[model samples]
Target chain A: MNAMTMIELGIAIIILIGTIVGFLSAIGFLRLPDVYNRAHALSKSATLGVLCVLVGTFLVFLFVEGYFSIKLFLGIFFVFLTSPVSSHVICRAAYRSHVSLAEISVRDDLKEAIIENNKETEDM
Target chain B: MAIQVLANLLIGLLWVFFQDDWSVLTFFSGYLFGLLVIFILRRFLPTKFYLFNLHAMIKLLFLFIVEIVVSSFVVIGIIIRPKMNIKPGIFSMETTLKGDIEVTLLALLITLTPGSVVVEISQDNKIFYIHTMDIPDLSNSVLQSKDRFENAIKKVTR
Candidate 1:
């Protein structure tokens, strides 16, 4: 009936959902055949999972301290900005370091790009 | 005048409703402060509201909330379970998120979630390196991540 109850429900919902997804990502991380694949599960799912918690917090703050909601909004904005870039950097580093892939991977775009660069250098 | 009052009223209602230490006078004061801040800032900085995309952003927010709740449970489960049950490794992933802001947001999100740590990023900003506490097949998981996570972010931000 009260707003606190609603906020608590929202928070509980978010926590439950986050725990499930995080568990899945962790499972994927452990079970996957190679480092590259494990990276995928960890980065993507986890990023999404945390965002939800932050949002729940944001909503709670919005209801509790409406004036301070803007700050939470900014925090969400920062999360939106940083997660992908770090993931990109990490993935690229793994690629450059020659992390092996599973038998299932067929195409290697970065390798192809490297080959092309070498051939061009030879031609020159 | 009407719009201002409405905005103030809605914001005030939210504040009064959520506060643990409820005080009507304090709530009004806070609301007035917010309004004043917005008024002064608007003059110096013009903001693009992204009004058309607001609805889409809201939808993404909901989806993100779901992900967080699910993942938090995942972390808790890991803690409760034995370390021997864990499978740890690193993986690389491709992404279509072009903007720096978007990529960074994604990385921070990954870090915040349990069992996943974003280790590095590529110079081109197209790939992400991640460490996960558990995975069965790295390549498959990576692909799934791209589909599930990277794509979702692209839809929301772009």
Candidate 2:
């Protein structure tokens, strides 16, 4: 009973931490200036937040119920795999649609690449 | 190619769960069972089974987890600060990686690892346009980190 309680406590702490991280990521989304900045907060940090929560849930199912939740494991796996792709496509589409970076931001090497790409394609 | 391996792993994992034990014996037996299943279904699969190097894949996964944790803290610190002093920009990086699976994995690793997310890939997939949140020598930092990830990925795919 004592060991189970301890395990439950640990799981609760993990879930709590994940909620905090997710909250922070949301705040970051609202505070950031543009698409790129928002993507940074949403992609990696949010993924981490979800990961912690999913892991906590998985642990709970394993230890408390004495049952393995393959669905939860698959959830963790697919989220980790797709989060980056989702963020990558969003940012790519925004950039391709001529979304300008915020005034406070500096550096844009992609512009040159786009120019060169267009030139190469036109020549073909 | 990677799908077959993932399917096998899923089958193996399912076996462990079905048996309700987390022992190595259970997993290996499950893996053998999955192999038989795959053998019977080989005619239906688009890709053939290949030798999967577990050590390299584990190393890559470990590297990814470590990088994600470290970078998560870094970004969290930046977010919680009073002032958001960030110089976000998109930068192009050239890569030596080839093939669809390798390039895709590398891109995913880059997005997950550092302060960089892949904004775009060139038509030929030889170049990547990366967007990063800071400007205090982050491009080089990203390149160095990406090189580590690339080496790890090559061990698995190539």
- Candidate closest to the true structure, highest TM-score: 2
Give the per-residue lDDT digits (tens) of candidate 1, residues B1-158. 23444565677667677775477576887687657654654545443223334576677566555555555555556544554355555556777778776787566556545455666666688876565656554335445555656655665565
The CAPRI classification for model 1 reads as incorrect
Q: Candidate 1: where are CA atoms >4 Å away?
A: A1-3, A65-67, B1-158
lDDT of 2 at B9: 84
- For model 2, the docking class works out as medium
Off by over 4 Å in 2: B3-31, B34-52
- Cα lDDT over the full model 1: 0.61
Write model 2 residue lDDT over A1-124, tens digit each, in one string.
6888999999999999899999998988999889988988899789899999999999999998988898999999999889989999999899989999999878888898789878988999
lDDT of each: 0.61, 0.86
Give the backbone clash total of model 1: 79
Write model 1 residue lDDT over A1-124, tens digit each, in one string.
9978888887879877766666776775776666655555655576666667777777667666665565668777776556655555666677668776565544444565566657888999
Name the lDDT value of residue A98 in candidate 1: 79
